[model samples]
Each structure stands twice: as structure tokens, then as C-alpha cells.
Target: MEGLHHDTIVDGEEDDSPAKKQDSPVEEELVGDVRIEDFSEKQINHSLAPEERVNLYEQMVRIRRFEERSLRSYQQGHIGGFLHLYIGQEAVAVGAVSVMGEDDHVITAYRDHGHALAVGMDMDECMAELYGKKTGCSKGKGGSMHFFAPDKNFWGGHGIVGGQTPLGLGIAYALKFNKKAGSCLCFMGDGATNQGPFYESLNLASLWNLPVVYVIENNGYSMGTAEARHSAGEPLARRGDMFDIDWSVSHGHDMYEVRHTINDALERAHNESRPSVLEIVTYRYRGHSVADPDQTYRSKEEIEEYKKSKDPINLYKEKLIAEGHLTEGSALEIDRLAKEEAEASAEFAQASPLPEPTELMDDIYWETDNPASKTSQGTMFFETP
Candidate 1:
């Protein structure tokens, strides 16, 4: 990794100081052009078993139907707060998570319902969380932006931009400290690529050789802003150039490509204790959140075109049918089952109870054994207002 000279401009004037020539080792190595690889036709074939193919299709359909129902529920005023639907980006989560081991950690940004479902989080609990019911995965406290399942190694859906970046590093460090074989997969949006923590976390992960996979789900928009408007270069994978980490771009619509890319990346992470940055080029069918009308920036025609050409569910279904791994009737049956499951989850959420008012203070602080406890020696005391 050789360093390259970058000219600094201030007030429309170029700075030519010799001291500026001393670029950081990371910066120096960031000079080369980034190449995004696409899997060959042969590579995608025979990668998954017949049952695995069916499972992938089912998972993608489940996520799609679940989000569609959630969108309807939100419109009906049954669900409150911001609802970020993961309508079109199902293939990314399902494919990447398909290759993960049982013990690997998964974290992501606010658009996390798909991720939670991909990692086997209960659909009833996820829907309940969105409904703010007590039976939710986060006990109805975290809401849509903070779904967590520690038992499944799903860290959370962080509300803040780029908040999970450093947290992922921390988890990776812990895995390394414990001599664990599993790695952490941290998913973020293209918008998060501009945040400071994204860079900071990557730097440390590279320097420490932490076992983490930093995935940027580039859906071409930072809210309503197009990627071209917000970013200097389109492919966010190059952002990894500054770090001593492997980086690549994968098509988010293709589950096979996503699974293969992530599987290879995890192999490197486990074998060499290295981190990787994967930029999965995907798109969101809905607005950034339910609040924004997505039409202000992009045309409806564009969305329809993407749906026609690159919809993940349709693409995978066609693949399965073509490969003789699934029948058209079976695919339709799977879709029906997914819709039924999602509807049942919504019903369960509706029937679930709300959290008690007194429960507001619960899980807010850690209880510690205080020596000065009045009750008894080694008694636990929790500080309160």
C-alpha cells in the first residue's frame, strides 16, 4: 500500500506546504482505484442446495410481506413513531445472513426489521416491538429503530447515524479477546459513510486486525438526497481504501452473489483475523421513512423500472424456477405462507399488552452490590432519582 499525494485547497487557494506531503500510512495506501467484482455465472450456480434456495426465497418473501403489512398498519394509525420499511432491500440481509454462523454478531442501522427477521428473530416479537407492545423483542422500549436479540447475537437496530460502527468494533474486540472464532457483521447505509465514527471504527479495525465485516447497504439515497448529490464517488466501497482491510461491491438484488461474497469475506475474517468492507448496491422501494414522499427526488418511473429489472424476490424466484429447484406453484404457495405469517404476526402484536407505566424505569441502570447497603452485606443497590 503506497501513499499518494493529495493537494489541499483552502479558500480556493492550494496549500503547497512540504509538511502536507506527509500523509498518514492509511491515506497513502488509499491512492489506487477500487474495482467492484461480479460473480461469474458458474460461481452463482451450485452454490446453494435445493432446500437452501427455497429457504432464501421464503425468507425474502417473508421480509417483503412483513414490511408491507407494517406499512399498512402504520397508515391505519396502529403503529406509532418513525417506520422505516425495508421493502426492496430484502436480498441483501437474507443473503448476507444466510452465510453467517450461529454465533456471529449482527448489527445495523434503523432500517433493521429485515435484518432482525433474517437472523431468525421471532416475527411476532418484531411486530410487537413496532406496535410498542410489552411482548416486543426490546420489551416495547426500543421500538422500530432498536430491535435487539442478544440470544441470537443480533446486537440492535441503532437509531443514530453510524452509531453501530464503533459498537461493532467493541464486539469484535471482545470476540478477539475471548479467542472466539466468530466475527461481527455491522450493516450501515450509504448515508453513514460520511460520519466520523465510520472512518474511526474502520481505522481501528484495520490497525487491530479485528474480525468484523463493515457492510454499507448503498440504496442510492441518504434520505431524499441522491448518492451523486451527497457523495463524491458513487461506489462507497472505495472508502475502505484508507484501511488495511479487504473491500468489494456486490449486487444486493442477487442473493447468490451476496451470499458468496459475504461467505468469502467471513472466511478471511475468521482465518486471518482481518476486517472487510462490503458495499452492497441495493435500493429501497419506500421513502427514507414513512414521512418523506420519495417522489421529490426521484421519479416513480425510476422505481418501477428498478422493480421490473432488479427486484430481488422476483429475480430469485425466476432463478429457482429456471434451476428446477422450485416449481411455480411452490413459489406461489411460499408467497401465500409468507403473507399469512405476516398477518398472524400483526394480529399477535395487536393482542399483546402494552408495557405498564411503572415499567418506564426498568432496565435503565445497572444494580451493583454496595458495601454500604442498609439491608445486608452484598446487597444489591440501584441508584435512583
Candidate 2:
């Protein structure tokens, strides 16, 4: 706690862009718009019921542990294929997923383990999927980048740069057309934000008033490219205004800010049937995809500074300890449990068998009204059930 106060603000934002339009104090006062309950400075949050607070903390811890274990396993050559870690971006997952229930949907790029865990997907199942085991979430057909639990409302882990954006919009459109109250959270990195799907998805989402939250995890780099060198406008939050959608930009490292942003976005969606884009300015502590070194893009000092100063888990722990909800022993116990869970997940994946080559013909498709829409896989030409 001695050094906690100095890290209060991770991002020192100064913008003279049109997005920084000043709000009149008198007008805001007349409408009670500045009420603390009504407006929050950031999306990461902590003002909630004890149960909810504990639950959010658990999710973030689970995400951190999951990433740590996965990265370790990848280094040891236990988990094969592309493994993108959402290490420092756990707050985005914990805060956003906390706002939704079973019926709502989620979609994101390859960095998906945290999103799955946040949405109540079993860690064991997720790990099994990563290991390409037959008992995996996608039945081992898809590994780290393509695990889809439709029954769990997880649309998928898309690999294409900005592929999931359109699919997410379609899902939200389907829900709306079907008279369901569910919305979709479409997540992508800052690198993917400039892709065609990003603009196309936003246009259709806002035009149709689809209930979709297009979240840009701005981690300052798209692979080895820095944001300043890669993006024309580093701020993604204000980009939504051009499409006539409401948005919030917040520090992705702060849970309080994330929670506040999610609540606000969902409120606008539920009340007015609108779309939103919540830009979370976050950073990933690891390399882009377990293949490249982040040193090519960022300095070691900056990384270490973020690691020491703005760790989401430590920040939340400090707050909880200050408020007396958490003790040092209890916090350590939580960490122990997270590590144990990861261990169990690894064991489960180890014991599970991989899918057979012939079975690739199966588990690829489901039935539809039109028989022609059925998909087949492998050289056997057997229709995937």
C-alpha cells in the first residue's frame, strides 16, 4: 500500500479532438447528468455488492492464472498451435463479461481463454481444447483459435484479423429479429480495428441498432507494430461517434473503469436499442502469439514499469485490502487455488485423448432446414453431423 497512491492513473489522456467536446456544467447539472451513480470516469469498476465484487475478482484472478499456466505449458511444448495470451487484458474480459447473463453471446479473436473462463466455461474444458484433446470444448476440431461453445453462448474464437465482427453483428441481428433480449460482445485488437470488417460491422450495427458492443483491446501494438506507427488515430473510443453510436474510452488495466464502462454501454443498449464501442486501452505483457518477442516493439523498462505499477490483480487486491475485504493470507490462498485449478486443467487435458483423423468428417456441422447447407469434411465426403 505504500506505493499504491502513485499508480492511481495509468493513462494521462490529453486530447483536443472533437471527441473532447466540453460539457457545460450548468446544463449537465440541470439534467443531473454528472451524478456519480449515473456517470463514471472509466469502465473498470469495483462499486458493487459484496458477492459481485468477490465474483469479479475471482474472474480476473482466474484469467491471470489461466494465462500464466497456458504460457508455461506452451513453453514446455505441451500445448501446440497458436496460443495468444490475454495476460494484461484480463480486466476487459472480467468487467465486460460480468454484465451479461447466459442468453447473451460473446465473440473474439484468438486471445480467447480469458473470455471463455469469464463466461463460466470450465477451465478444464478450455485447457482440453487447447491441448487438442477429444474431450475439448470444440471436440478437438478447433484448438486455441477456434473453440466455439454455442450452448454456452460463446460464438467462437475467430482467427481472421477482424472476421468475428460481422458474425457478431449477424448474431445480434438474429437475436433482435427473433425477439430475444440478448446482445453480443464482439472483441478485437487495435490492429484489427482498421480492417474492413471493423468499419462494416459498425455501420450495420449502428444502422440496424443492433445490440453489439464492439470492444477494441488497444494493447499499443498489433503484433510487432506500435500503435503510433500503425494507427492514424490511436483513440478508438471516439471513432464510434462518426457512426452515431455512443462510446466510452477507459484504462483497460483498471477494473473499476472497465465495470463502469460496461454498465454504461449496456444501459444505453437496453434503454434505446443502440450499438456501442468501448475502447479499452490495455497492454499485453507477453509477446503477440507466443512466437515473437515483444522487445521488437516495446522497451523492457516500459514493460517492467507496467508489470510493477498497473497490474490489475495487484490493484484490485490493494483496494480490497484497504477496504478490509481481503487479507494477505486470504489473497495468497486465492492465488494458490488459481494455480491448483490450472494444474487440474492440465491434468485433465493430459488424460484426454486426441480426436481421430476419420472423425474430422464429423463434428463440423449441424442440421438445418435446407439439406444443401450441410457441410462435409475430410476426403471421405461424409457429412459432418
Return the top candidate by lDDT. 1
Taking the tens digit of each residue's C-alpha lDDT, what string does model 1 give over 248-290? 6656777876887787778778989899988777788899998
What TM-score, over all chains together, does every model reach? 0.85, 0.85
Q: Candidate 1: TM-score? A: 0.85
Prediction RMSDs, each to the true structure: 9.0, 6.3
Stretch of 10 with least lDDT, candidate 1: 1-10
How far in Å is the alpha carbon of 225 misplaced in model 1?
0.8
lDDT of model 2, residue 53: 72
Which tens-of-lDDT digit does each residue in 111-140 have in candidate 2?
Answer: 888898887889888999988888889888
Clashing pairs in 1: 3-28
